[model samples]
Target: MQIYKVGGAVRDRLLGKPVTDIDWVVVGATTEEMLAKGFRPVGADFPVFLHPKSGEEYALARTERKNGRGYGGFIFHASPDVTLEEDLIRRDLTINAMAEDDQQNLTDPYHGQRDLEARLLRHVSPAFAEDPLRVLRVARFAARYAELGFTVAPETLELMRHLSESGELEALTAERSWKEIARALMEDQPQVFIEVLRECGALKVLMPEVDALFGVPQPEAHHPEIDTGVHTLSVLEQAALHKQPLTVRWACLLHDLGKGLTPEEEWPRHIAHEHKGLKLIKAVNERFKAPKDCQELALLVGKYHTHGHRALELKASTLLELLQSFDVYRRPQRFEEFIAACEMDARGRKGLEQRSYPQADYLRGAATAARSVAVQPLLEKGFKGPELGEAIKGERLKALKAYKEAASV
Candidate 1:
């Protein structure tokens, strides 16, 4: 059997990037032969084995045919007769179809190298349209390599639009869709991922809540980018630029969804949108089953991002209530992430990206001051049970009151 390094390993190497994980495609190999050679089988839908020594995945060269609908409706055929070219043709993108031999000779029958030089992400064949997952994969690749000026080919984008219009994207399971969505959010240009999906019309099908934001009006004074959708994408860009974690990025993406639901008659003024957005965020989280942290943070940011923006103006009691609502004493990290999301929102406006965001530092200082009040001192003054809890809260409020006074001075 001849083993060749395939997929992302070869693609990243060609791009002069560091290769982290290497996948191998074995030609002229059967399952029985792999087992006899001390490889461990792992794939349930196809013939994939782990190398005994290297522990890297080594999948047998195989071909697939669309058996039904969605990404999972496929039948795989792998045998000694399967050619390397045949296996490569079944892949989603041309750049991902090249393989490397032991002698370092490249087999790129699909002209992946040509596309790489052109900085284009093209499909290998018409067969690329058969899998719905390719739409997200190509968009994600666009997000990943956008800094290198990579773009999806027009014809391939047409196929993605066709797939979106063909009702196939809806067949993707939430888990499958979330996998791509989460990975794209972590990319350096997550906003590009959404842009590509919108161009292909997949955003309307997969995330209508977000899609509705397009063309929706906002106050140009606050958001020089008057479109709610444009501002949301800018927020996502800010999140990526700051290298924020996934939870903060996710919050930034969904924080303005309520603005999409605002009445057109109320254009440019979503007076109570922060409260209006909480249910929408909940629905999106429920649809994708986002991680508990992601769901909770999204809700908090959606419902109280305005409060974070108004940090300096809020009354000391109101600020204390907000801090207690976040339960910062128990989960400070979540509170920090909330501040990050708010900062992204504030700085996402057009021509205002470099503006200062003192609200973040101010709120952090308030939390620090409130927490510095000693519960031991209150207890030593004969405060007991519920009374002790009240005394501690009173001291904490006094600390915040003093902090607010000092900051004003």
Candidate 2:
């Protein structure tokens, strides 16, 4: 039997990208033969096995039939009669269908090599429509490979549109959907994937709230055209450029989700978007089963958009009392992450007149500076005893407020 590297590892290596996982196809080998040759059986739902010596994944040549729905609704076969061409046909993308031997001899029966060389994303076979998850994968690939100038084959996009409309895409679990969506957002060009979702009409199914942002106009003083969807996309782009953490990136995308749910008549004149936006983000976060940490970031971004105005108007003692409740000044990354979201929120417009206020920069900057001097110093001092602790706390609060005000100016 001959073993060869196949799928993503090979594709990534070809593209000069880092290989994170290794996959192999064993030609002219049976599962029993593999086990006899020191491979352990590991795939119960499919025909996957692990090599005893290297522990690398090796799947025997197999074919399948749909027995259920979504990703798990399939049957597999690994027998002597199955050819590498047949096994490759079962794959989704052409570039992923190629295989390479230890000698690096390419086995590309379906022009996958050609597609990769051409920097195009194309389906392996007409059978691509049979699996619903491929739609999401195409969207993700668009994001990950947009810089490479890859375009989805028109027919494949059309098939995705059909599959999403038929509700097959909905059969996939939210966890799986979120995993793909999150990864796509992590890509350098997230807008490509998002735009693909919009083109395929899948955004409505996955995030209908976002779809409402398409044409919603904000006030002339607050924004030019102020389309909620445009603002959200801009926020996402800014977060990506700044390399914000995933949770913060998510907050940026969902921070303005409430604007879509608000009444259009309120527009520029009576915008209480921060409160409304936070509530919608909370519901969306819950639906995605986001962790408490992520939920907290979303809530903070929502909460503090209006807090700056309230803070600017408060007396020092009152403001100190209010800010003390958060302790956000103690955690700089948390505060910076919130600011990253806010900064992106503010930049999502045309001119200065469109801004909600003087931008959230002053508040975010002030908070960051305060946390750096006060919280970090206290932690570094590491003083013990009740009197020392109280002294540190008192000094920190006093220093934090002054630092914050300085940053705002």
Candidate 3:
């Protein structure tokens, strides 16, 4: 049996990128043979094994046929007769279809190297449209290589659009969809992921809440971009620029979704969009089954991002209430993430990216000062139970009040 290093390992190496994982395709190998050679069986759907020494994944060279609809409706054939070229041709992207032999000989039956040099993302074959998941995969690759000046081939994008309209995307499970989306959000140019999805019409199918924001108008004075959709993408970009975590980035993406629901008579003004967006955010979370931390943060940012923007002007009681709402003393990290999401929103507007967001520091300082109030001191004064809780709240309010007064000077 001949083993060839395939997929991402070879692709990244050709592009002078740091290869983090290596996947191997065993040609002319059977399941029985792999087991005899000490490879441990691990694949549930097909013939995949883990190397006894390196523990890296080694999938038998296999070919797939589209048996029905959606991603799971596929039948894979793996045998000693399956050719390396056949396995390579079945891959999604041309760049990911090339393989390398142990002797360092490269095989490029699909010209993946040529596409790589041209910085184009082209499909491997006509079967590319068979799997609906490829639409998300292609968008994710675009996001990964966007900074490298890579663009999806026009013909491939047409196939993606076809897939979006084919009603096949509806069959995709929430877990699978969320897996791709969460990965895309962590990419360097996650905005490209959203843009590509919107271009191929998948955004409306998978994330209509976000899609609805495109034509929605916002106050031009505050948002030079003036398009809610454009601003949302900008916020995602800003979140990446700040190197924020996934929760922060997800919150940034969903922060302005309520504007899409604003009445046409309201035009550029969305007076209560923050509160209005909560339902949409909940819908997205329910649809994707997003992680609890991600959903919780998104909900908070959706309900109170405007409050963050107007933090300095808020009454001391309002500010204290906001702190209590987040439970800042117990979970300071979530508050920090909320502040980062808000900062991204504030800077996302056109011509306002570099502007200072003093609200972040002001709110952070408030949290710190409020957290510094000692519960032990209140208890030391014979305050107990309900009285102890009340005394602690009073002291925290006083500290926040003092902080606000000091900041005003």
Candidate 4:
């Protein structure tokens, strides 16, 4: 059996990128042979094993036939007779289809290297349309390598548009879709992911709430971009530029969804969009079965991002209520994440990216000062039960009031 390094390991190496993981394809190898040689079986869908010593995955060279619809409707064939070229042709992108042998000999039956040099993301074959997941995968690769000047080939994008209209995307499970989306959000140019999806119409199918924002108008004075959809993408870009975590990024993506639901008569003024966006955010979270922390943070940002933007102007009682709503004393990290999301939103507008967001520091300081109020002191003064809680709230409010008073000067 001949083992060759394949897929992303070879692709990234060719691009002079840091390869994080290595995957191998074992040609002319059988499952029985792999077991006899001490490789541990790990693949559930096909013949895949782990090296006994290295623990890296070793999948047998295989080919697939589209048996029905969607990504899962496929029958995979793996045998000693399967050629490396056959396995490579079945891959999604040409850039990912090349392989390398142990002797450092490179195989490029599909011109992956040529496409790589051209900085184009072309499909391996016309059969690329068979799997709906490739649409998301292509968009993700675009996001990951966009800094390197890579773009999806026009023909491949046409195929993606066809797949989006094919009703096959509906076959994707929430878990699978969320997996790709979450990964894309963590990429360096996550806004491109959304843009690609929109270009191919997948955004309407997969994330209509976000899709609806595209033509929606925003006040040009506040959002120089004027388009709600453009503003949302800008926010995502800002979150990525800030190197914010996934929770913060996710919040930025969903923060303005409610603006899309505003009445046409309202035009640019979405007076209560913050409160209106809560259900949309919850629906998205429930649909994706997103992690609790991500969903919670998205909800918080959706419901109260405006409050954060208006931090300095809010009444001391309102500011204290907001802090209590976030349970800032117990969940300070989440509060910090909320502030970061709000900052991304404030800066997301056109021509406002570099503008200062003093609201973030002001709110953070308020949270800190409120948390500094000593509950022990109130309890030590013989305050009990409801009285203790009331006394602590009073002291925390006084602290926030003092902080606000000091900031005003």
For every candidate, C-alpha RMSD to the true structure in Å: 1.1, 4.7, 0.9, 1.0
- Candidate 3 regions exceeding 4 Å error are none
| lDDT (Cα, tens digit) per residue for candidate 4, span 40-159 | 999688999999999999999999999988879999999999999999999999999999998879999999999999999999999999999999999999999999999999999999
Candidate 3 — what's its lDDT?
Answer: 0.95
In the predicted model 4, the residue pairs found to clash are none
Give the number of colliding residue pairs in candidate 3. Answer: 0
C-alpha lDDT score of every prediction, in listed order: 0.94, 0.75, 0.95, 0.94
Report how far off residue 46 is in candidate 1 (Å). Answer: 0.9
Model 2: per-residue Cα lDDT over 150-256, one tens digit each: 88888888888888898887788778877887888898878677778888888887778777777877666656646767767776776777677788878777776
Error of 2 at 148 (Å): 1.1
Backbone clashes, each candidate? 0, 1, 0, 0
